[model samples]
Target: MSAEFERDGTAWISASTGTRWVPVIGLEVHAQLATQSKLFCACEVRFGAPPNTLTCPICTGQPGTLPVLNATAVELAVRVALAVGAEVAAESKFDRKNYFYCDIPKNFQISQFDRPYCTGGGIQLPSGRFVRLTRIHIEEDAGKAIHDRGDETLVDLNRAGVALIESVSEADMESPEEAVEYLEALKEIIRYVGAGEADMEKGQLRCDVNVSVRPQGEPWRTKVEIKNLNSFRNAREALEYEIPRQIEAYESGDETRFPRQETRLFDVRAGVTRTMRSKEGASDYRYFAEPDLPPLALSESFVERQRGLLCELPEARRRRYREELGLSEYDARVLTAVREVADWFEAAARLSGRPKETANWIANDVLGGLADPKIEATSIDELPLKPFDLAELIALVAEGTLHSTGAREVMGEMLRTGAAPRALVAERGLEQVEDEGRLEVWCREALEGREQVVADVRAGRIKALGAAVGPVMKASAGKANPRRVREILLRIIGEDE
Candidate 1:
């Protein structure tokens, strides 16, 4: 068998015939719509609301109750479809996917089957590789089944009848890393459109990955589906384990051990995929048009309206930041990582007319402050500090009215109390003292007994001046303008020379 070492040093061997096996990967990502109500009812769409409390007659599938679609959910799904450049259909229909699961009180999920709302768009990786999409279908989520609590399984129907959009990708990914990149990009778009939070931890977004391995020029093999991977790391780990297991199975020439069309669950603890059940095809689920809900017909105007509402996506924003603001790629990526943070930075940048400095301050000071545990506000929106105030702070530093260290202190006070940056600088006595005479005294005192540093500075090793400036700034209580201090030190060394 042919074997090669992965970057992490894991050995991946091909079949016994020395045939190189390439993994084919596809993903179905289900994102919960960020609507206020369930798909077909007015029950509040909430997470962690004491299980089953969010359910109502329509959501619970009472015998006489009929489903009335939530308009907001459809709009949210349309937003995602438009964001991804999917072709939104003029007409689509909901079908009953017949299944008997306790979590699904309806015994059949109302989902779009043949006539999904949108199709034919894909996510582009950072490498410019496009992972083509097959289709995106609208559906309702089933409730959670808690199987870990003893023998008697408990069902939480709070999530029942929640609106979801399942975006199915083609088998366009060959490696786990590409799959993850695609997922992250998709999630970013989803959040950008306000379609969903797409947080994996709260099950707002979940993925099902199908994988198979085949010889380089062979037809596709039987793909096995790994279900309900809550995080990207789990998806990658599962694929890492499964691809090799399937290759080893095929290599052994054991018919029973060959990869089959089946559903599996990721055993996160063991880092393996265990068979959940045989895969069910469309014929098995017995999908049929739901008699209660008629086919959804959308006007061209509605589609255009959603298209008009499309904001600049993260990729385009990153490009703009790089081209217009002269920011490094890393800075552009960090600024656009979140919509709120990007908006905040843009506002600050506009006010200060200093894009690079504003970006740096937001990246280092604002984001770092938000990440602190002591900061009650987790999001930029929650903070009382305004972007304009941050702009003013950046301007102060750029104007040499405040040094970076003093600006940082002012920023901390601004974050804590939403006070003006200038006021904080004044109140805390943090303004830089640029007086030539005063700074010279501190510089002269710092140069004392540091003859080697002075000698180096005199010999044209100007960087040695940094060694003397620290004690000068310390003596000046951090209020001395460091640039002016440097100039004074240079002049003193020149006079002595």
Candidate 2:
């Protein structure tokens, strides 16, 4: 087993049979741009078009069909770059990445080499750690290959020529947890900026994780690359599994003999990585500048115009929620977990006159119930209660007109009947019973009925107070204010003694 040491807030595992520490990680995330057309072709970039139905000669890479760059893609790329604090280059160029795959009819991919469109961006994690971004480059995705169980490999050109932004980050992430966090932060930015759909399950976002293991106080070892991780959990699991396997190889005195660079594929069901092939260096791709498309040029005014349209990203919004809204970290995180949820909370808070209480109910009560799998499938906008309706409910709770239990009932009624909060409270008589004299009479009757518990309370068993409170709440059909019930119980017990 490899010894583990902490560095850069991440645990580094030692190579086998050596004192060398390996802290290996890098990420390549592919985000499918939500463009109406493909990168070099005018064909529609629809997902579920029939096989080869959406193809044109330009996308199919027919001879003499020169590729043209899409201007809108450049603007979207800049927007994503600005959202993540990246520096946009005034002039960026595209290159041809030569490779041969059956799915790629062109036998070459048009992508950016060293001079990418955007570079040197960093995303701040929730833990205040910074994950450095190496570059964000635009490229056209190749078609996909599907093999049937019995016979032949089939190719689908529907996805060919689709626009994709390959966002590469440095080997700065330390742990599987941080890796997921980085992916999530990037996904949120892309989604908020309307750059991509960013749905991992739909293959809109895919990751390639580079992992290596070394001992403490040592340089990184030769790293292995894991590709096509479809989900964040798979990315984390692949790293978790690779770290130990690599450590064991080094610990068994095989460091010098161990293969340094290789490509591995993660098997989600089997939970292991099998060697796919040897990794290739940059020279192997024979990258060269594209002749058909000219270099991209951006004016200062154009870049500034795109930046002006950018909204406050999730991290900034989260900070404002904490500072301006006076919400706890947990509450702010919950409220800002989704853009829709945050928008709804802000709308409700504006009308409720109780910002903190409105946030709490939305984050804890409303979102908590909506987490049910069935409810999650349905849209929140389709629900009966509007944002102002939720605000009204919170207002009633703050004004002491509804007990906590009664508030839940009123909320449920609002969902079912779409009634106003005050109207529901009045119609159902769900208001809390706060009349102290009436509560006193009910408490005395409860004490008389629970003779044994009353005797225990008089004998100094103060915990029996809950017993009396429960009966009072039950007597009032859960309408009694619990605080008032407690007060009446104390008074009744004192007078009896």
Candidate 3:
């Protein structure tokens, strides 16, 4: 595990194994495709519809009904593959993964096996470790069984046959934090290309994590698969408990008593992983090509155009913000995490022609007011304030026409009315008091009120300048420019001599 920690203000305690053992984690993320229909059927793919209402013979596996590929689903999958710099196989096919379950009405899932849509790419986590990807395959989602009621279990088939893209990562992550980073980066890429929303809480994105503990610099231990984690926090909490639990088990028991590789479920209430079933190998599921579906092929031109759909991804944008615009690494990451925010930031940066200043304003002023950092708004135009408006606000502060504090106040109003910064400043009387004559009056009042602090400054306690500045700001009703206040304070304190 990297020693650098990025909790983003949350208290994320590290998963420790007494410093002798390490946890190897790999994640299988399934993202629901953003399409209007299911993968194989034309039934309307709407969530919250009445249970079983969206089912049709095609999706329900009526014997004579055959499956057909959804063209939109495949293109979206290809876009996801390309966004991560994966190689999109020119030819791919759907296979039948046989598994008997209530959710899988067909008794088999149409999935990609042996040859997937794309393979061999990786995401570089924020910790500078690149988590390699095994493959990204297309598949159909199964329905859900609502078992919470007292007696009866109801089946919801609305999600059945919905298109999904499963991305598998190699066991490269060494800690819980790295696992979260890899998933976050993957979700960002999927969302950047308009492929999927990747909201885990809404069941739009699901994850299965493979966790194992091994002695430092040794061969693999028995790997446990934590299945169907709905949220990143639970996944992380599960690892924090599971890793130490396994280490304790190994230390306490003999070789035969140690826990082996198996499938487990993350108990959100208990904050631990409990065994669900023994983990199965690939042979357990009989895999064969779906006879109803034909091989999927794409032309070279079509593939190129799909590649052209690629915009600047989060990683690239973060790097550009850091290297080209001179933003700190933290600032860059915050700005580019959302494509809409990045687009707005780039426009503001270009208009203001000041990258660092614009970045500071957006990071501190704009995103701070958001209800969610990962906001679902699709475009900057949907935001309350436009990009040019942000640029104008930055320009006002830069020209000393507005104090930084006053700019923040104007920003709060801008978000409500989408008003221009200058207009808001005028209406609110927030313009900085740049005139030296008026500023002198405030400074003299500050000196009289804080005579002891002024005496301390004259006696060489220069840090007391802060005390003088606050009183001046208060006297001016926060309209005074800090820079001018300091100059007048110095002149009054005889420092000009």
lDDT of each: 0.89, 0.84, 0.84
Query: What does candidate 2's lDDT look like per residue over 1-497, in tens digits?
Result: 23553334465534234353445688999999989999998999887778998889988989999999888888888999999899999999999999999889999999999889999988999987799999999999989899754588899988888899999999987778888999999998898887888989878999999988777667778899999999999999998788777876776676665647999999999889889999988999999999989999888999999999887788988899888889889888877766777778888889987779888787656765565554432545556678899988887887889989999888766765568999989988988887888888888888876887878888989788898888888989999999878877877788877
Question: TM-scores of all models?
Answer: 0.95, 0.92, 0.91
Model 3, range 27-68, lDDT digits (tens) per residue?
999999999999999999887887899999988888999988
Who is ahead in TM-score, 2 or 3? 2
lDDT of 1 by residue, 1-497 (tens): 13332333122434346566788999999999999888998899888899889998898889999999988888888888888878999999999999998999989999999999899888888766789889999899999999999999899999999999999999989888888999999999999888999999999999999999886768999999999899999999999888888887887789999999999999999999999999999899999999999899989999888888888999899999999889999999899888999989898899999999989888888888898777789899888788999988988898889998998888888887899988888888888997888898888899999999999987889888899999999999999988888888888888987
lDDT of 2 at 95: 97
User: In candidate 1, which residue ranges exceed 4 Å CA deviation?
Assistant: 1-4, 7-19
Q: After superposition, how far is residue 345 of candidate 3 from its true place, in Å?
A: 0.7
Candidate 3 matches the true fold with a TM-score of 0.91
What are the RMSDs of all candidates, in order? 2.3, 2.8, 4.3
Worst 10 residues of 3 by lDDT: 4-13
